[model samples]
Target: MRLHLRLILTVLLAGFAALVAAGPAAAHVVPSTVLQLDVHEDDITVEMTLPTTDLVTASGIDVPVDGTVPAAAAEQLAAYVEEHFDVTIAAASDATSATGTWNVDVGDVATAEVEQWGTGAFDAVTATATLTPPAGADLRSFTLDYDAILHQVVTADVFVLLRSDSSTGEVEQTRSLGAITLDTVTGTVSPLTVDLAGGSARQGFTGMLLLGISHIAEGTDHQLFLLTLLLPAPLLAASLAGDRAGRSRHWREVAPTRRAVRRITTTTIAFTIGHSLTLALGALGLPVPQQPVEAAIAVSILIAAAHAVRPLFPGREPLIAALFGLVHGMAFSTTLSEMELSGTQLVLSLLGFNLGIELMQLVVVLLVLPPLIVLARTPAYRPLRTTAAVVTAVAAVGWLLDRVGVPTPLSTAADSLGSVSPWIAATLWIAAALVLLGTRGRRSGIRRVVSA
Candidate 1:
């Protein structure tokens, strides 16, 4: 075993040394190109970011990246990219080679500095090209035979990413399809094989659904706002809320299960309705200022946290939810609109996405609500609830500050809290179980003393 371990360690050390030695040389071999492809309703559009220095190296012509590429150089580069970049069919049924043709409309290039991978403000060219497939061709499976920079500078790496495919509910995220580069040993540029697994309309709808679920799961402000509002749900307004009195006649008492359920259901539905309208409107082309929307979302959470602590909106939690949900809806719409969907595709995606969000939202409500309600009946519940509310408020303040351009570690820590939600839920369940067990044991002991 020792001999084997030493051999393994030696191999790893040698590999590390090789990589360390090659790192500097690898950096100069070729700069990477990022290609974002969007498969629209009728055509495919590709937006490519090519390093300006690499472009000049490949074309043997000076490409300016200061502003726009110079008119003559721009034309030459466009022609070159169009001639070299193409999509080909995958071979089928014993066919030795893949053969297909596509119509390409190469657009003009613009120059800008890109900071991806710490490339450090390097000049790059951006182009939007349209590819029209043959009649009844499957756009999902094809070989993107790109040799733009690879042919000239054989070691260039091109990363092909799919930004959106409205037909399949893939949008607003950069998903790597594959990389294209020259094989060092073979001295040939290999084509990137893109197979969007199981591409269909249903797949698109499902993808949107999953995206919505993930949105709810990952969005801290949204999660915190709803949860903080629900924090005081089972308690009597007068008993816990400083100024919330006479809203319900049952003062100094926990709310009944039915009332708690009603509040949760109503508030959730109201919030959903609020965001849904905005999501639809935004997706349908309503102008939304993103910065204000983001700041407003943080503010909403802050307000909700405040309400959770005090009796700001005693019995009208649903109404408050509706008002805030509108702001959140605008935020939600930004996700859908970024996909650039139109017509039926937009409608379907919107439905699937909303449904998905609601599902996840429902899961979150159910998970936390049960323990909260159970704990509300315990003597220790009030202090615990208030502590949670205070923590949530602090996080909200951090978010508010961060959203408005103030950087703070609190915002990052608060954001990372979402990753540990399952553990939080588990802890809540364990606490609830302990509280119930202790209550039951006390009751049994009291009965025994009376009998004795």
Candidate 2:
């Protein structure tokens, strides 16, 4: 009896130790299968990111020697997933009542790695499972009966992410409806009936607005180009404004506050108009060559940077801004036109998106302009301008090379520069304050010396 009791205790202790060790091993275990659902007007795009081992186990496919899934295995996997996955879409009025056989087609299958989870460390396969309902069927409100991985591995969970549902206001941002995991006791997988509520047009418009704001914020080259052009605004163009007496040209002392403000405002407005027109036209069936537009934007930055170092365009900053703004507009157009928007949706999205871009541009201008205006009067302004122009030129050259097919770290660093924007803003404010204080102290000292 004592020996039996000791054996039982030994077993329990071993199990307890194993459970304790599993706490760290949790990461190694597959978390859950993710199905990214992107909803469009006519159809729904389902992106499945499934673990390789789990897929092989679930589909019962033979692994090839090269560790890559063979054609036969891939087809088998797709067939198994399709058998377990389905979506039932109905008309807006009969969404709850209408129930008939719906056709769900699994599109091209592609193997993908979960790069973020771990690369060369973990394996995942991605496939596009599209469901195109009948012409009049509503995409916004539908029932999704997806039982992909959970069908086989009862404990396995499936995360359903609303990637880009125009009707539900899920664009670049994602909102989780819930997970599709089995009830361990009941051993049942339930349907994820997604009845996304709200106006598609409104959702699309707002989504595009937020996207535009994010796009402008991330496109460092665009902001850099604009800021560099504005660098020389406060300086007098002197002989470089038109014709010199054939003597060496130079930027004169800072211009009046009103003149500087006027120049900045004009430049900002020209850029807005330039980009807005192209953004609208591009969405309204304008064919924009993406590659050339990207390259041109980089070139625009380089040109602006050079202009700052030496008065290339002089007082014609707004003209240059407008011309390059056309290129930037084309770049911006790519963001909207890719959605394949049309009619009222297209028009509203275009308006809302441009409004967002303008709003952000204005905010950035307001944040950076005051410092530039304050510093222009200082003797250090010329050197400051030269340094900023040089840095911008370097970043532009990096981006130009990258867009033209040559990759470098400078572009990456420049792109990441946005992460430190808060620090930059803080530094600028502190510098402006110090400049004001120094100037006041100098004036007081001069008065005292004169009185003595």
**Per-residue CA lDDT of candidate 1, range 185-211, in tens?**
988887777776466768888989999
Candidate 2 overall lDDT versus native: 0.74
Which residue pairs overlap in candidate 2's backbone?
none
Tens digits of per-residue lDDT for model 2 on 1-452?
23322433344344323432332112444546888877766677887877767766777776442345678777887788889887776345374554554567775666655643433335677778887765556666677777776767776778888877655335667778788778788878877777676766777778778878887787777778877877888887666555557244567768898998899899999998899989888987799988888889989999999988777776788888888888899889876765666677777788888988888888888888888788777766676677668777877887888889998776676665565555555655666777788789999999999999
Model 1: lDDT equals 0.78
Off by over 4 Å in 1: 1-31, 59-80, 88-127, 134-137, 171-175, 183-188, 193-197, 239-253
Question: Worst 10-residue stretch by lDDT in candidate 1?
Answer: 20-29
Worst 10 residues of 2 by lDDT: 17-26
**Candidate that would win on lDDT:** 1
TM-score quality measure for candidate 1: 0.79
TM-score each candidate: 0.79, 0.79
